[model samples]
Target chain A: MFRAYSALIRKEFIQVSRDRNMLRLIFLMPVVQLLVLGYAVNLDVKKISLDVYDFNRSQTSRELVDAMKAGDYFIPGEEGQTKERRPLWHLADRFQDGSAQMAVIIPEDFSERLTRGENVTIGLMADGTDANSARIGLGYTAQIVDRYAWKHTGLSPPIGIRSAFLYNPETESVYYMVPGIVATLLTMVTIMLTSMAIVREREMGTLEQLMVTPISGFVLLMGKITTFAILGLLEMVIALAVGVLWFGIPFVGSPLLLLALAVLFLISTLGMGMFFSTITSSQQQAMFLAFFSTIFAMLTSGFFTPISNMPQWMQYITYLNPMRYFMTIMRGILMKGAGIADLAPDIIALAVYGSVIFSLSVIRFKKRTE
Target chain B: MNDKIVVQVENLTKRFGTFTAVNNVSLSVRQGEIFGFLGANGAGKTTVIRMLCGLLLPSSGMGKVAGYDILTQPERIKRAIGYMSQKFSLYPDMTGRENLYFYGAAYGLGRKLIGERVMALSERLSLREFLDRPSKGLPIGWRQRLALAVSTLHHPKILFLDEPTGGVDPAFRRTFWSTLYDLAEEGATIFVTTHYMDEAEYCRRISIMHQGQIIELGTPHELVKKHRAANLEDMFVDLIRKRESDNA
Candidate 1:
């Protein structure tokens, strides 16, 4: 068994090495995706372009503008250029041309109201095209305005809520996105390589030739999947390294624990790949099927969006997606420094998915080959 | 070169859904004999070879190859036989030597034994010039030779060749036949399927299958004389036409 398995693995490695396109895809895919998702898919909602219309032009109004600029949340002016104030009537033009995302208008009597201890309402308008950034920008504006009012008016609010964000206190979206990208990269590489490799053999008619030899189906499957598993782990390591070295994302958890769970995650992905190979007759068909499944797996896995934000019914359906548990496990371990006990439920779910899907796919593949 | 019965099958049947591919076929081949299976396209020749090689399970059959049951001892049967599929099935991206080593290892040959066999077969088949190049870049005849070398690396007691010379030129076909003769001379039973009448004439005995049933089986000379035909091709066409009309 060992001899046959080794020979099969050696043959696969030779083929993969010779195929230039496959080699390019294997190494280049993770790096490109890491750079794209790390830089472009950011959701931290920083550096909003704020257009301030200071109608009063008072000392207090200037102080309010300074307070708004204090945090990294807002940048005053148009596209961070030309700090000289533009006419207030041009606000509509600015929002339409996409130069400014938000504008704040202070009432002319803003200082008189504060001196008399009377309430005043400042007008705030936002371009709501990107609802996420718009909503977050508005919330930040409210907090800044309230803090400025409390400081100047000498009136403290009755109740206050102090909330601290753990894991990612600075709220750098790259830290969250890098781990999700790692999970997705592993899934895509393993599923595409395993299914396509097997289907390629079937296309060349070598699968029948192999079956006619003395090698058992078990040996053939292990040889193929084991190679792909190693490749998937290699891709994950590359992605994680980019996350650490390039993105400077912290790895607070145990590296050994992460590696162990990653192997467990591979069982399901490789099984899914084998299952696709059985159902597909050609490399293109296998590729399309694998792609379709990964898209669903990614969306439902909460890699881009949180599962809690999905519809309640859709949330229940996510229970069937193995990547969902893996996504949580990745984030939990890498970001929160979670241990095995802290991630037991997710780990248990992932283990169940891996074993059940793997056994089923193996059985199906054997039956198909026979 | 002996009279030992190396292949024996009785009422072997295979069905895909309701379509019967090999129906109630029975045949036996002796040790070291070049047994020919002649049939047109979709005539169930490949189906029977696949069944005997244990790549497909017969719907119902009692068959044995090299004294191992095809149904119960498929792995042993696989070890005892070398099968060359009709399609050119070697890995195109891999060198011929790599393909040979892979299949050799698949047949459970040790690395040392595989190296020895590969060396011997390369010399015998004159494959030294093509072993280092990828199989895809080799000419068709050279690729076919490489495939044959791969199958025979383990030196099985029986070898099955399905349409071994389907699309090759006549000169390459002659060379392929000579290689087969060499193997038969080395005490290996050969089961080969082809539609070429000239190739069938080279066999000691041949069976003509039509629509999942063997319509005629005998020595080529005997069959041609018994049917009063000029050659094997004429006799095969007559048998097929007769069978089609009978069904009609």
Candidate 2:
């Protein structure tokens, strides 16, 4: 069985090595995506253009106006000095049209309310059509204004915000995004290529030729898993290097722990793929299922948002996702410098998924006479 | 006589829920004989081969392939049999040598055995020069011959060829027949299916399956004599017409 499985694995490696494009995709595409996403895709919104609709020309309103421009998040732009009372709507359109992203509306009563020492709530109209961008912009605006008011007013605030952000310290998008993208990339390409190899054989009518041989399901699955695990590992290494050196994200975990976790992740991922292949009759079905499995992995896998932020029920559902634990292991190692002792639960979860899926795939493949 | 029976099927049936593929049927293939299975498309020749190869479970009844119980020794039968499909199954990107190597390895032959057998098979298949070139670039004739060589690499006792010579030139088809005879001479049971009537003439005995039931089974001459037909194709037409007439 071992000899048969090793032979099968070797055959898979030969097939993968011959295709230069697959090799390039397994390594290069992940690295490029990791770098581009790390540098460009940020949770903190910067350079948000704000159109000022300042009807209050008093010194207090001017101070509010000055507060908006004090941070990198809010860049003060065209001030509409119009007699029209409804200039705020027109300014909202400009924000929608990309001239600005956020519109700051200063009420005409702003100067009088501040002199009376009453707290003035400044209206911030953000286009929440794209909610993520809008939320980031809104948070930045609130933070900057609070700081400016306390600094300029000579009012020593009684309380300060003591915020403890969880997971990522630098709030670097790379630290969070790299793990998810790696999972997605490996799941996408490794499955497509591995599953497609069988599909093509069936199309070519060569699968029957292989099936008739002494090779059993155990041998075939082992070959597929080993070959894909190597490719998945290779891709992870390349993506990790780019994440570490190019993006300057720290990789502070033990290499042995990372390697061990990756094996469990690849097994569960490839095992699911082989199960899909067994059910799928054609390349189209394989491709469709591969796409379906990974999108849910990306959206629900807690790579972008806090899984804790999800409802309690959704958090329970995500436990079934092998990708969720893989992302946990990846982020734990890559970002927080977590060790094996800290990640024992995640390791056990991945092991369960792998053992179940691998066993199911092997058991599912019936010998023709049976 | 019992030793002569390489495969024995008794009232074998295959059904998918409500649909019946291979109806209750019994058949046997003799050792060291060219058994021809002839039928129109969708007549379940492929289905029977799959069942014999342990690809699908029979709905009812039982069978034995190569002296092993179908249910108990399926893995053994799988290891013991060779199958050449109608469709060209060779990988397009791998050279003839590479494909042969992969298939050989898949059969669980180690490095030394694979090397020796590939060398021997390549020379016999006359693919020595082109083994380094991908199978896709080879002509249809060489491709079919190469596929046959790969299928029989393990020297299985019973070889099933499902329309193995669809696209080969007539000359290679003749050469293919000669190779089948050579393998048969070595006491290998060759069970082949084809739409071609002339190929049926080369078989020691033949069976025609229609809608999953074996309608006619005999030596080629005996079948012609029984139907009082000029040739196998006309005999098949006569049988089909008789069945239609009987159904009506």
Candidate 3:
């Protein structure tokens, strides 16, 4: 069995090497996608255009406007002023036209209220179409205004809360996004490549020839999985290099642990590819199925949104997604410098998922061959 | 049953939903004989070959290949046979040598043996010049011959060829049959299906099927004599016409 499997692997590698385009794609796609997606998936809403409707021509209002402009998150937009002087109405137009993502309206309290020790209110309107950026923008706005009020009034609050971001001090999206991209690229490439391998053989009529040979289905599947697993590891290394070297994303974990975990992750993904190939009769069907499933897995893996924010049932559904555990492991290791003890549960979940899926796929492949 | 009877089938049947592709088809071939299976399109020739090759299970019946039950010992049967189809099965991107090496290894032949076999087979089939080139770029005749060489790399006890000579030129087709006869003389049972009636004449025994039933089975000369037809092709047409008239 080992002899046959080794021969099969040699053949697969030879085929892959001959196809220069596939080899280029296998390495090139991850680097390109990682650089592009790492920057594109930023959740930090910076350079948001801010339209201001200051009814009060007071020093306090001027200070407030200056404070909003001090932060990198908000930029003063030209649309805040109009010849007709209907700034409030124009604010709405700015939001509709996408000229500004946020608008601040200050009332006509001519600084008398602050001198008299009366509280003043500021009206803030943000486009809620993109809930994520809206929420981040709202949070930044509240922090700036709260600090400005405290500084101007010279009053220390009776109670205070100080928040510090751990692991990623600056809240750089690339720091959080790079690991997820690695997981996703590994899953996508491994699953897509392995999924098409068998179906391609079937389509070319080579599978029937292979099936009639003395080789068992298990050996054939092992050969396929082993080849793609190595390829997946190579892709992961390339993606990680891009993440760490190009993007400057920190890799604070043990490289050995990451390697071990990546192998486990590849088992599940490669198994999934094999499963898709076995169930599909054509390469097109295999491609569609792999794409559909990988997309769903990436979405539910908390690559972008927080799983904690999902509905209770949906969060439970994520328990079955292998990508979820892999994403957690990746982020935990690369970002948090988490040790094996800290990631025991995630490691166990991945092992279980990988073994179960791999076994099930092998069984299905055998049954299909029979 | 004689020990020399390499393939034995009794009432082998296969059904897809309500339609039967092969119904109560029974046949046997002895060791070292060239057995030809001839039929019209969709006449269940491929289906029957697939069953005997252990690629498909019979809905009901008893069939054995190389002393292993088709239903229960499919893996064992697979180990004992080689199959080539009308559709060229060699990897188009891989050179002929690479494809031969792959199949040789797939059948668990060692490196040294595979090398030796590849060298010998390429020489015999005059494939040495084209062995380094991808099979796709080679002419169809060379590709078919390469596919045949790959299939027989392991030298299985029984070889099943489904329309193996479907598109080969006449000169190459004659050479291909000579290879089959050589293999038969070397004690390998050849179970082949073909559309060319002239190729059917080369088989020691031929079975003509129609609408999922074997209407006639015998040596080419015997079938011609029994049906009172001028040749094997006429006998085939006569058999089909008789079946149609009976249905009418």
Instruction: Tell me the whole-model lDDT of each prediction, alpha carbons only.
Output: 0.84, 0.76, 0.82
TM-scores vs. true structure, each candidate: 0.83, 0.81, 0.83
The per-model DockQ list reads 0.58, 0.48, 0.54
Give a tens-digit lDDT track for model 2, residues B1-248: 12589899998888877877888778999899899998888888988888888777778878999988776677889878888887787877778877777787777777788888888887777778888887888999888888888888777899999998987778989989998998898899999999888999999999998878998899999999998999888998888878779988
Off by over 4 Å in 1: A42-164, A367-370
Candidate 3 stretches greater than 4 Å from native = A44-164, A367-370, B1-3
Binned by DockQ into CAPRI classes (incorrect, acceptable, medium, high), candidate 2 is acceptable
- State residue A303's C-alpha deviation in candidate 2, in Å: 1.3
How does candidate 3 score on lDDT?
0.82
Rank order by TM-score, top first? 1, 3, 2
Better of 2 and 3 by TM-score: 3
Top model by DockQ, which number?
1
Task: Give the per-residue lDDT of model 1 (tens digit) for A1-370.
Answer: 8999999989888888888898878888889988997788745577778877777677887788889989988877642213565666587677654467677777688777767777777777665433345557767877887788788866863112232222355556677778777888888889999999999898888998898887888789999998988878888898899899998888889999999999999999999999899888899999998888888888898776556446799999999988888887887788768799978988899889888988887788762234
When sorted by DockQ, best at the front, the candidate numbers are 1, 3, 2
Give Cα distance to truth, residue B97, candidate 2, Å.
1.5
Which candidate order results from sorting by lDDT in descending order?
1, 3, 2
